[model samples]
Target: MSVQPTSAPTWHRLSPRMLAIHPIIELGRALPALVGVFFAGHAGGHGLLTSLAVAVAVVAVSITRWFTTRLRITDEQVQLRHGLLRRRTVATRRDRIRTVDVTAHLLHRVLGLSRVVVGTGTSDRKNESRIVLDGLTAVGAESLRRELLHRTPVAMTNQGSEPADELARLERSWIALAPFTLSGVVTGLLVWGFAWRVEGESGVDLLHSGPLRAVGHGLDAAPTALAVVVVGAAILVFVTVTSVIGYVLAFWNFRLVRHDGGAVQVTRGLLTTRATTIERRRLVGIELSRPLLLRAVGGARTLSIATGLRVGRGAEKGGEVLLPPAPVDRARAAAARVLNGATALTVDLVSHGLRARRRRYVRALSGGAVLVTAAGVGWQTGGSLWPVPVAVVLLATSVPLAADRAAALGHAHVDGALVTRSGSLIRRRVVLADHAVIGWTLHASLFQRRAGLSTLTATTAAGRQGYRVLDVETPVAIALADAVTPELLSQFRRRPAPAPRATMR
Candidate 1:
């Protein structure tokens, strides 16, 4: 909804990035508008001067429309104003702001710009977005963030260099790669090889259906085996190239910026890059994942808290990613910062049966597959020692060790929070507001009920980190929730108590 200014309309700077995005506003519609103007001018064909005037009028209007649009960034609030005929100004204050994000495209790089989005509201923080500044340089965006944070008071910390009420920082970790792309390549190559092998088999020609009917019959339908081979090779090459590019783009230049206060900011991207903020208090949990191939490379998976956060409505998407791809130690340390727990101690939470089945066997299987494939390739090409298979085998050997390390990454009693680790391969460290939970829930599947495994879910006032918990005894999960609900509410009280300087051992 467009906000009505209370006192006065204050003008704000137009970040270069935001101005560049001005063109996007007229996207798709610009062509039609131009077409309409051309026809109207012809319809009103009169003296040469009148025709020239009409042309000039259209050009002037378009430029004015682009230039007149403005965004107002004030200490108290942010406002967006645009449109020649119908304009809107949406404003939200700082206290209500829950999430802030920076995103840039390749175009942004050339233009030296990025977009800032802030979101408000906890329950549905994802939807309440404001582009406080669509395009701003790195420095301007930071200054604007400080301005908004200063004018808008958050309960987490006051705008000062005072000792924090609770000292915490967010760290970043990433989920390992997805296996589909690689598997897809393997599938394509296998199919092509099969097609090549069977292109002239005795029964293969007999079973020809679509190709035979579409063209003619027999050899008439088939434009030589060479054409078939070339086409298949082209398609496979295209698919493989696109897949590789997508992977590189997805994880290009990933970085983590740790904050002194319990927060961390991460930025990564290839074409359209993204910047995310991980606030310690907003994180409810963490998740880890590893594909079969990634297991061979000793990589891990991670995903966490994007729940309950009513990012109090400001601009853009507010929640930080609970997922990323990172190594085990880094993931643990990141989680430590978020939980305000010790990085020194680690714990083991993996069930013995599941650990072997999920973590160990998979690693072995992936290693064996790569070794077999590499050996076959080595034989075909007359290899000198097949170094590829050796690497694969050794890398696979590290999977269990990484899982053991991440599992050892402990979650324990901190002064004001609960921290936990999940993932055998990709480790995710999660932090929860020990005293900020407003509701608690227990979830159990039929299998869980049978095995006495259930999960606990907790919700907080902020929109993010308001969702599910993992495996626990059903009854225990329920009791844990019930016991903690009242205790949490009471402990946080009207406001959070001062944060301890260091967690106790």
Candidate 2:
């Protein structure tokens, strides 16, 4: 859909509700500083008046910013002008736009408003490349999202495109996969660190508080090993509960759909609803990720390998995620649907030879030996000796891990697509289209050269740019490159002498 001005092109202000909510958003963003101010006031340093004044100033600045900001949509581009003392304007060409995502947090949803972000496929700095329109009516935001996503330079008067077919919707049964998908250990450590910080800052021992103290007392009479087991179990339970709640909140009511103009649309989240449109043309490949725990449960997640998607920007939810964690079969099905019948090319990958396997063992065992040696030396120097045994056990375990990793590493070309499988702990199978590959790089370390092995990286304009087929036989790497793009590497290949003397013989 392309939106045009009814009369002369004119600038528009944000929803008036922004005046009420913008300040609150600003304060929320500065919450940590505000908390520090309150702590200072409680400690008899900064007075209550100082905290109040600081908050008031922040709100005043937010109001000024709200009033100064204005947006306008013209025939060729979308423009935003803002700032009080230093006025600034940003504009993005409509044809260059790759994604338009709408997000509504709890407060914004309550106010019937949402935020719109329009981005072009190329900027290193997200803020610089994207235009954000905050606090627009939900309906208005949706309209803008569609208009930006579907607009073309030649068709300025086209009506909004019809909604595309839904490819997948949230399934209640899929929720069972949540606990497996969540990083329970990491979440538990974060929670522990946050509690410790609060205790340190407030000079209150949270562990010795009423409920915690009672729990501690209950475990004090148990054997040391039993107490450790009890505490570990408690932590595991806590982590699992938190992980489940978080997974549910983040992916509540998730839906994936195929939108017009070859775009894929995703709508998800609970407290903060988000609608994201990704241009299908930008998608170069799909990654099927299986973490250790998830793999144990036969679950996997799908992420699009595409250009214009920001990585590590939105908590753990990067822009590339196409499907949340689900059963491995279901994930593969979703990938096929998203790719419009392109099945996963992960079957029957060409394996590296014995030399590669030997190299993996050497690398893993050497690293493990270093750690074991360090631990042993530390123990001899009167440090805690417990880690020495642990290090020895880990070193012994690396043998199997190395074997598994070597067995898992493989690559193959099928139906104009290149498939690469690697990783043991967190397996990732990448399926990239051959045509998407722009170049190839061959690298050989000293050991690799002696072992007649090399790493071949397929370079592309989209996705991670470089995807490797690691530790393949040197001839195989060259053959793979030639098979993928013959003309590009043909000149570098030495042609065998034509069967010369057959006629003479």
What's the TM-score of every candidate structure? 0.53, 0.88
Residue 1 of model 1: what lDDT? 11
Give a tens-digit lDDT track for model 2, residues 57-144: 9999999977899888876788889999999999888788877778899989988988888867542234577888886787777776
- Model 2 ranges off by over 4 Å: 1-9, 43-47, 84-86, 122-127, 152-163, 185-223, 313-316, 380-383, 490-505
Candidate 1 lDDT over residue span 156-265, tens digit each? 23234322332222232232233332534645675575554444321234235675454345435566886677668866676666545554565566665555554455
User: Candidate 1 lDDT (Cα, whole model)?
Assistant: 0.51
Q: What's the true lDDT of residue 495 in model 1?
A: 81
Per-residue lDDT, model 2, residue 130, is 81
RMSD of 2: 4.4
